[model samples]
Target: MPGPKSNLIDLEILDGMPDGIALVRVDGSIIHMNAALRHMCGVPDEPGEPLKLESLAVPDNIAQWRRFFTHAAEDGGPMSFDATISRASDKFTFYAEVSFHRKSLHGEPVIVATIRNMSRHRKIEEALRLEESRLEALLRLNQMTGEPINRICDFALEEAVRLTGSRIGYLAFYDEEQEKLTMHAWSAQGVKECRISNRTIEYPIKNTGLWGEAVRQRRPVITNDYNAPSPYKKGLPPGHVRLERHMNVPIMDDGRIVVVAGVGNKPEPYDIRDVRELVLLMEGMWRLLQRKQSEDQLKMSLAEKEVLLKEIHHRVKNNLQIVSSLISLQSEVATPENMTAAFKESQDRIRSMAMIHERLYRARDLAKVDFGEYLRNLTSYLKSSYQPRTAEVQIDVQNIMLDIDRAIPCGLIVNELVSNAFKYAFPDGRRGTLEISMRKDENGILLVVADDGPGLPPGIDVSNTPTLGLQLVHALVGQLDGELALHREKGARFEIRFK
Candidate 1:
């Protein structure tokens, strides 16, 4: 007796409704019910034209429901509550969502109540929560893999004992070459703190014990019932009666077997998959430790090389000083003018080599020398070279260090420059002041050698000077890969920028 469109609307509403429905009067008398309510009440019959609300079977918390209904009937209008209900089969429990609403039906005040079964949904929620917990635990294991092996092994032993609800666990480190597995750590507080003075153990790896099998096969081995006939029975120590289960996993370092992490006295056997996962984590931690050890060894080797180089420089300095003393002694006994001049030249050569070693001794790096110190020493030697009894030479140096390759050529250039100043710049009883100064600027090394004597001979151009000293200076500057500027302001200023 319904039209097609009206029937379609009724079907849609019925399918969309979430829970059971019931109609009751203000006084709590049952009037009508829906299919969902019939299933929940576990009765198919209407029971004498709609049973009384209190007469119909309900949950033990029905008094709380009535109180909620009365409260909804007041000015607030509607209320909701949750409770657990038992099914008629007596095998299943359901979470019930109940709602009460005060409304008018057939122009009479009534209360609309609804209930929904939530047992299946609750199961799904619990499963999701458990999966999330497992994922978090796996993440913690991965983070532990980044630490050192000793720490990782310690954490693994603690986790294994805790997971199995056991009171004792120990880890044995396998010495592959020596065929030994020594107990390194134990869960018992007193045992771990005990000093292990006796380090060697006669652990035979070729035997059928759990530690030997794990190391030889590169896998994990478990003994669930150690009390029964077991391959590892002989490996147990004397008076060791409490161990009921055991598991051993191999730890690898750089793809090579390193240690066997054997756990004993477990409450029960661990799964094969769990043993494999823990071994894999231990392998990763061992790899990190191996890399750190290699890097430390490399740094130590480099430090030793530096020490050897410094010692070589120190020996060279001592040898050159002995050569300089020989040259000075030879020059003191020479009488002929030519012999004295030859001996003096020999002394100069030895002094040059001595300067190199002297600078090397004070340098932090043996491969280079301080350029400022070299220049000052060379100028002082040249001032003495002329045997000038009146004029005094002064040196103004700046801070700079040059590699040995550059220092040698630059030192020779300073020697020639100072020699020219003492020889020709001052002649005929004329006293002069020679200033040798150097500075480092953004451009490069700024070296100046000037004198307060008569300027270069009137007919000599600095660019085309025919002097041997000038020629040597030009060649040395070229070797430095630098440029030279000639200034005729006070005396002769040869300014160079050598990078």
Candidate 2:
């Protein structure tokens, strides 16, 4: 007889064990079985007494199990066997490690054996194999579509169908402004419809459809059965007739999505692995497209600038030639004294206009002229006409820059004033210095040409001067739409205010 507390203690240890355990007699009859073993063997009730060990034998690998058990029983050693077992008409595979050892309890020999359920371990192994297959498929998808935009897009359509095990698939891009999904390309069987635009049909990219939902959520959505009534099932447009299993995901570049791709008519539901790879392929594709557009715009601007420069050079050259011809023709017709004066004036006028064009065409920047350089050239030309020994004259010019429109008039004004100074102020061996300074005041530009020679002849009013040069100066100054003032101190000072 056994104490009730002692029997409960033994039962508690059997129930607490993680692995299944059973005990057998030397004759191969069952002695005891733990709760783990009973549950694993599908024996719902506890054993009231010892039963035959054959009841728990795994049918598929019974011979192997029997051999291992038989050897363990005789040799009192451990043996391991992988077997499939039948319990209540259901078969389960297991990896079993069995050890048979003789135990002396009050001088009676007994064999204690342990068994464990390996069905969970087998399931884990199967799952790992499936995951590896999926990862390999993704790697192949990436490799096939990584060349550039054109090839990548072509490969993407092909791989979409291949990876999803689909017979037909369509890739489309959403035009958000147009509210349409334009089909870019499609692949069916071993051939792809490279004329994606032909297969393309417009559809609203609203929140209700598969494509719209993917874009709105910035994620992938999959439908395993298109015909079934489910939340994922959204009505397709007229052209999407054969679509069964469908998948759509937003393609993003630097967090901004310019397009969405929808793959449909796949044999099975698409997975996250496919979505991730498609996004990677599209990132490269979109980037290249953007770069191509920018390059095209840059080329366009360069061509436009070249055309404009050529046109400007052509017009300036033609106008300068026309003016030079008119001036030469005018000089050929006058009498000797008048002819000499006419040629000189004509030459000076042509030279003034020529200087404008010369500055415009020769300058790296065409918008403005170097005023100091223009003045020096003009003054040097005019000074050549005067004999150096006739007057000890000095010219002081300041450097400045002005645009051609203002520069032409400004140059002519300086030429005329300097000529007048040489002709009248320094007449009869008088020595003098001419100071030509230009400065900008708060109100306007100030042009000053002062000569340190004999003062203006007594009682000669510059406003009503009879000399042609002074009259020409007044007329040219009036043409500037500005005011002119004359000062006679030590010599003569002419100041013009371009207000």
Number of the top candidate by TM-score? 2
lDDT of 2 at 476: 66
- TM-scores, all candidates, are 0.36, 0.38
Cα deviation of 373 in candidate 1 (Å)? 42
* Error in Å for residue 7 of model 1: 25
lDDT of 2 at 254: 64
| lDDT tens digits, residue span 338-383, model 1 | 6866565556655665687688766556667888878877777777
After superposition, the stretches of candidate 2 with alpha carbons farther than 4 Å from their true spots are 1-150, 157-170, 187-198, 206-208, 216-218, 230-245, 262-499
Q: Residue 298 of candidate 1: its Cα lDDT?
A: 70
lDDT of 2 at 348: 75
Error of 2 at 72 (Å): 10
Candidate 2 per-residue lDDT over residues 110-165, each given as its tens digit:
56667766677776875576456555644554554325555556666666555455
lDDT of 2 at 378: 75
**Cα distance off (Å), candidate 1, residue 254:** 5.3
